[model samples]
Target: MIQWIIPLAFICAGIIAGLIGEKVIFKKLKTFVTEKEVPGSDIIFQALHRMTFVWFVLAGFFWAILGSPVRPDIANAFQKILTIIFLYSVTLVLARLTSGFVNLLVRRTEGVPTSLLSNLAKIAVLILGTLILLQTVGVQITPIVTTLGIGGLAVGLALQDTLANLFSGFYLVISQQVRTGDYVKLDDGNQGYITDINWRNTTIREISNNVIIVPNSKLASAIFTNYHLPAKEITLTLNVGVSYDSDLELVERVTVEVAKEVMQEIAPELIANEPYMRFHTFNDFSIDYTLYMRVSEFFDQRIGKHLLVKKLHKRYHQEGIQIPFPIRDINLHGN
Candidate 1:
């Protein structure tokens, strides 16, 4: 009964210490962590909460061993086991904390690749921590490092395409030539808004509700037009044709007026710019001209064009202007 009571008392003490950690220490720590709102700190605190009980148990274990009549060899072995557990737990916590913090930083940052970097950071921390832990447990690391070094060359050769994509992705992000939310069209006609750049491929979302997955290497090498760069403001041209008999001055005046109104109503941002028209050529049926206009961006042009055409058609009919279609006349002298 006495033997059982001694172990029970240690266990009970551990439980009480765990309760204190939760009620007192954790409460204070929680307040501090929440106030700071630091990226990845919450993850660290969560792991710490679970470890609190284990920590108390370790302390109780140490005290129990010191006070008991256990043999020297058994006690030393138990102590080693406890120390190893503590070290490994610390390693795991630090690794996760490091990775989580990097991820948080990436989300807040602009123009940086998040998922790839986050994963690389995690793998690096784990590898380094594993090496240290193995050394602590009396395992030599030199042989392992040498083995990896030899195998890496072979792995690189086997994964040439994958490595090409990975490096290209790195280059793309570093160069900042192409970026998220930019409307782009490739030379081969695959055009879309760049959505995200991942490890193996870049995700492009087209205006037609389709997605195009182009490999990073291919995207980097491809000649693509980024409408967002240089400037988002672009010039839009619309061709106009009225009957050859229509007044040229009146045509310009009415066309400009319609364009100005459309620009104002649909794209107020472009209203300040003056619209211009040039009579380029006299076609067989009508005089053809081009109307030059300004729009905010790629999508705004659609609205601008729609409004301008609709308004111009109605305005032209009201003014009795004729937009003649093609007409053909043939004279036969076969008699």
Candidate 2:
């Protein structure tokens, strides 16, 4: 009974310490982090939450094991196991911390994929931690590394497609040709905004709210147009035909006025490059030309066109400008 008191006391102490650390210390730290608005406070708290209590409990158990009346060999073995567990937990926390920070950094920079780089950072930390853990347990690393090098070749050969996608994802990120938030139209006619480029695939979200998952290798090699690159501004051309007898100068002035009004409403920033038109073709019944207007982005063209057509049609009516319909006259001679 007397011998058990020390071990029992240690166990009780561990529980108490764990409760205090988790309930009191964690709450205070979280409050501080929130109040300070630290750059990575959310990440730090997320990685460390619930871990404090476990660590304190583990520490208590380790001391209790040392004070217990157990065989020397058995005690040493238990201590070793506890050390491994503690080290592994620490490794997990470190991995999370590194991964979160990497993602935050990538988000701050333009044209970099957050998921891909952050995942890679986490993987690297985990691999390093694993190697350290193995060495701590008296396992020789040289032979293991040599084996992995030889086996890696075989694995790489077997996973050719997987490797291709992985490398292609890296290329996409580094090239910066295609980036998240860019509106792209693929060769296959699939148009969407890029959401993310992960290890295996790139995610695109269409205007219709449908998602497209294209493999990294395919996306990298595929012919695509990135409307956001070079510039987000694009010219929207509307082909219009008016009655042949209509006054050309009046038509141009009225059409341009309507276009400018619509553009100002839809995208005011593009007003510097005012809307214009040029007569291009003469038909039997009407004169055809293109009215060119500027829009902010690819998606804005829909609303811009809608507004422009409504305003142009109303203004044309008020100006007595007639939009003639296709008509053909036939002459028949009886022989």
Q: Number of the top candidate by TM-score? A: 2
Q: Per-prediction count of colliding residue pairs?
A: 0, 0
User: What is the Å distance of residue 30 in model 1 from its true position?
Assistant: 9.4
Model 1 scores a C-alpha lDDT of 0.82
Best by lDDT: 2
In model 2, which regions exceed 4 Å deviation? 111-114, 330-335
Model 2 per-residue lDDT tens digits across residues 185-204: 99999999999989999999
After superposition on all CA atoms, how large is the RMSD of candidate 1? Answer: 5.0
Candidate 2: clashing residue pairs, number: 0
TM, every model: 0.70, 0.89
The local distance difference test score of each candidate is 0.82, 0.90
Candidate 1 lDDT by residue in tens digits, 28-50 = 88888799886566877865766
Deviation in angstroms for 78 in model 2? 2.2
Report the Cα lDDT for residue 313, model 2. 89
